[model samples]
Target: MPAFEALQTVPRSGELVDKAFSRAARAGRAKEGIEAQESMLITAANILSDNLENVVTNWPDFDTVDPFYRELADAVCRDTEGVPGVDALRQNLSEVGWASRQIDELRSEYQGRIRRSGPDTARKVRKQAFARFADICDEVEDDLLALGEAREALKTLPDIRADEPAIVVAGYPNVGKSSFVNHVTNARNETASYPFTTTQIRVGHLTRERIRYQLVDTPGLLDQPADERNAIEQQAVSALTHLADAVLFVLDASGDCGYPIGAQLELRDELRERFAGAAAADEDAVPIVTVCNKSDRSRGIEADAYMSVTEDENVSGVLDLVVEAVGHEPELPFDG
Candidate 1:
């Protein structure tokens, strides 16, 4: 699973303000005279600053996030109305961080004034600091709201293990892509919804020679052409460009899947081009192995392999081909 799943809920500005002030009142009641005012100031400042800072810290550093997750986050935000892209998310977090520091500085400055004044004057100084604290919180209210929205959006991402070798199952809808994944993996496919569309991303796993391979079927995102896809789906494809170690392009030659063989070939070509472009920039190429599913129905198409998922024919052979194409070399320990 991606690390974003563990992110804490973002604290709203108003809720944080209320909680800080209420806690400050309790701390003040436990003290006397100028000391009481000082206590209140310290309590409020610490609570607000810590919480605001925590909100900033809780998010994974976008710069250091895995390219797959980072791009996915960017794609998620592009479709989110009123929510800016990844740069904006970084800026908002920076702003909230600045506000938190300002509150801490205000606390130190006000504490000196409270200590130098009489009880009545000290109380007034404390009230003045509270007003500034509230103002600061209000200043970053939108940033806080944006962070909350981002949290809600990102937490919904599928728990994809990035370290494992991933074989992405991609083809047009009803092309037996999901059926192929279901047949190859050990257990039932774990269905997870994509944040951008109602369609789900199904994940299943199989272990070969002590290496676990992840099989993913991205239904709504990769099942269409790049030009025909919306902004959200394009970003999703970009994510896969980073995530996939190999791609299994399934074809339904029978046209029983309702897509023409030419269309399936077109999508396969697009994926090949896309992955080929990515490979040029990296050390290794992500291999795409095309398999014509429902081979029992039709064998007219040219592909790397053939399988009938429904008939359980050559299914394991197709899985073998995918694992071989992935070509993930595991690290060996030093004998020394």
Candidate 2:
């Protein structure tokens, strides 16, 4: 098997296998547990090898293995039927996966270290491997935690901007916030055709006839709690509060914003509350311009008394309406 060949070539495979078995024994699965782990490892290796061989033999395009090893590890952890010391087995399997990944990383490092240090490399490689393994484990944990935090932040974010003459151009990421920005302004900003392409806020100035206004292309806000937003995303949202003359809330009519229209509207209401002051302070609040973008897509939530458009539709019509909504443009550019 290709996986077996790769495993055998690893200088520390024996040590890794021994350590895995030892951990399993300590976890009170000395008898069947060790054998089960070894069998699983061998099976995974063979499957991986077969998949690799197919890819190599095919030369160009190849199908990837279904149920990748990480998924297999998760499955193993969840299984408890007929397996003695099931918890121990799960832990052992996870450890084996870790060891396998570590071995692969070490092998790559060894090549680089050997080239730099010549023949006297064994001791340094061992020390470096230990440090690298610990670092990788810590990094994995930190990333998982950060992802959790980001999800929570996304949830807490308010959705609607009721009072602000704000125009939010929200849609599934990469659905043309930046493109719309370019169309409205002479400013050139990066516009890419990929998800999460705009990681930062890009604001531009747009002038049509005698009216001058600011348009902001905000970072993609997924339907999640506020605590779940990453630092960059939070900053992007914050930037909106600071620079927004009026919000052009953009929505990609074609893509899912991960929630129903009601939920999005609720979020918008929450945003209005958060950014706009109490009912008594309504006069100081900003007005929102709800835009349903990507008109090319037949699907769109009917915006309430606000402007909406498709991919082929120009925003100039909406802009004129917005100018009227906010009353005549200020004689001078908005000082705020």
Give the candidate number with the greatest TM-score: 1
TM-score of each: 0.97, 0.39
lDDT of 1 by residue, 1-336 (tens): 586998899989999999999999999999899999999999999999999999999988888888888887887765246343688789888999999999999999999999899977999999999999999999999999988888888898888888999999999999898888877786667787767567678899989999999999998878999998877677778888999999999999998988899988999999999987887688677899999999999999999999999999999999999899999988889989
| lDDT tens per residue, model 2, 24-80 | 334333324333333333333333323223322322111232212212212222223
Scored by CA lDDT, what does every candidate get? 0.89, 0.42
How many steric overlaps are in each model, in order? 0, 49
lDDT of 2 at 301: 67
* TM-score, candidate number 1: 0.97
For all predictions, the C-alpha RMSD in Å is 1.5, 18.3
